[model samples]
Target: MSDATRLVAISPLHSPKSPHLPYNRFLFSSFRFVSNFSNCLKIKHTWSLKPLNQQGSIPISSVDSSSPVSIDLKPILNEPQFDRLIHQAQQLHESLVVLWMANWCRKCIYLKPKLEKLAANYHPRVKFYCIDVNNVPYQLVVRAGVTKMPTIQLWKDGNKQAEVVGGHKAYLVANEVREMIDHEDQP
Candidate 1:
């Protein structure tokens, strides 16, 4: 469905008041606050679940894969942390999907959530991270050969294996990311 025709609901508690919450959602909201913020006013009451015995968060593995769960892609800043993350992922033998983007990039804001949904599909096994090109050292972005606003790269064996430059529409970029992940799975 086209974006303008699509309907979405945003709750106040779904509120991202904290910096710890997903920054991408914050960016999207900030960008279109005038249009979508009205949706928030329509919310008369906050949503709550029927008294459940559970309290803490559930691990993604325990959830059924049939249902798609979209989680925020964790942010990695600075070169040391970036190198350490790659090292950690390599040690664990996990693939890394890194979205090299900046907060100012509107395209990045649109693409981040879609990538997060994609991240959920491969959760734990293939971890996802977002490194802001503007935040990290310029050398890092240059070394990664990133020359675009929203560049999604798949890292395997401590190296970049595939990249999807998110210059097109969000959905198309998402599909290409999925295909990239699927294709990289084979020998």
Candidate 2:
């Protein structure tokens, strides 16, 4: 051994009341959370975890519900757009399903998605569009002779061939709209 080295002896087993213990759990205990409301000592550690997903309000889309076809409507923002689209469909020798809807109308809102799905069945052959009645000029609405909230019209060759006023249940309205489309299609 080097001169600097010091010999150490192993201590015997610690007695129950040993002055030098390895650890004191009480000395390193966690602090209790304090509440802002009062200075009273809380018996339990009061803690909470906020839910990751909260339940509230009407959902924009249905859960676990999906459309196989995933069809959508092309919106006509103005009268000029409406005229151009109708003319285009006429020139191409194809039909257009125009849904005349208003934001405030609950029936219009309900029937729209059903019609969109209906559009999927006629995909590529007949195009589908939506015109918010409020967005277009009143004069154009008068010219089209639309007097109701939800009007589903089938147009071909720059003319409205068939129409269904959808003021009833969505399913019935969808059926009427479908029948109109099918009826207009036949020679």
Candidate 3:
């Protein structure tokens, strides 16, 4: 499936009325497993249950529990309760790197786990975060001028340092980020 299609499949599009129930019902009822021409599975599966906040939406929580190696990409990205991501972004350190992505972006999903692993490896050094451009504030998006699906930015002392505009290879990006961190650690 195309990235856009995959993104749509995984992302729960906003519904004005009965947001949770409708989607839940659709999943338990209308949602069907269809084999594509290439025999690929067309349905998206979300087994983990997320916390529901007072706004009738779910809050994204990090998968930092028992499964340290496993990536909870959804919780890391989506947080309807918070207005700005700077708080979570700041959790890493005074310096941080934010990944601005869209749910329907295939490259984002493919690269998420790798990025998570990199964060796990470099924790407390390079703060890593993922923000869904579709759901985040428009002002920040405009400030960042993010026109692509998977844009990455490095911040130092809460200021913008550098950024990668599009989705690149995970290893390459990780190396670059590591280099940036190492450079900052220098005298």
Candidate 4:
């Protein structure tokens, strides 16, 4: 057989015996030799380029720092801010949407920005807040009955009225949240 063919055939045998110390040492040395040999060879390549359109212009940051920017849409991060938001919503009779999330959760990270954009539509009518499960007190999370990350709950009169466990796609979760808000009056 050719050298390459023999190498391919030996791969399966080597993998099965990888737990053996002697076999592992041999495999490590062989891999290092192959890697070093491969690194000695080099290839040349060329790239095609396109020029920029000089007529196109970019906008500069003209925003005033002194003026209070639009209602800071960032999610509430602390207990005091959370309590104050809930109290204000209760007093105003507005619906409150709290997103129970965790920093390490990929789904939660992706879902958060989408939810924030959605909040803009219901501005002044619905309030949105985010709680990182890792940052907050354990008792608070326990009280909410949050067994999973990215749990979206709608609160009315300081009570949880509806919940959307975001285990599915972002679009589906957004649709569910919208439906929940639309059908808030129903049981």
Q: Estimate each model's TM-score.
A: 0.68, 0.63, 0.50, 0.59
lDDT of 2: 0.71
Q: Model 1 residue 78 lDDT?
A: 88
* C-alpha RMSD in Å of predicted model 4 compared with the true structure: 16.2
Residue 58 miss distance in model 3 (angstroms):
35
CA lDDT, every prediction? 0.72, 0.71, 0.56, 0.65
Candidate number with the higher lDDT (1 or 2): 1
Q: Please give the clash total of every predicted structure, in order.
A: 0, 0, 1, 0
> Model 1 over residues 24-79: C-alpha lDDT tens digits?
22111111122335354232222222111122233333333333346678898888
* Tens-place lDDT digits, model 3, residues 72-164: 333333444232445555564566667788889888777665667666555555557788888767776777667786777776644567776
Candidate 1, which segments miss by more than 4 Å at Cα?
A: 1-14, 17-68
On residues 74-127, what C-alpha lDDT tens digit does candidate 2 reach at each position? 888988888999889988999999899999999998998678668777888889
Task: Give the TM-score comparing model 4 with the true structure, all chains together.
Answer: 0.59
Better of 3 and 4 by TM-score: 4
Candidate 3 local lDDT, residue 144: 65
Which is superior by lDDT, 3 or 4?
4
In model 4, how large is the Cα lDDT of residue 92? 89
Worst 10 residues of 1 by lDDT: 24-33
Ranking by TM-score: 1, 2, 4, 3
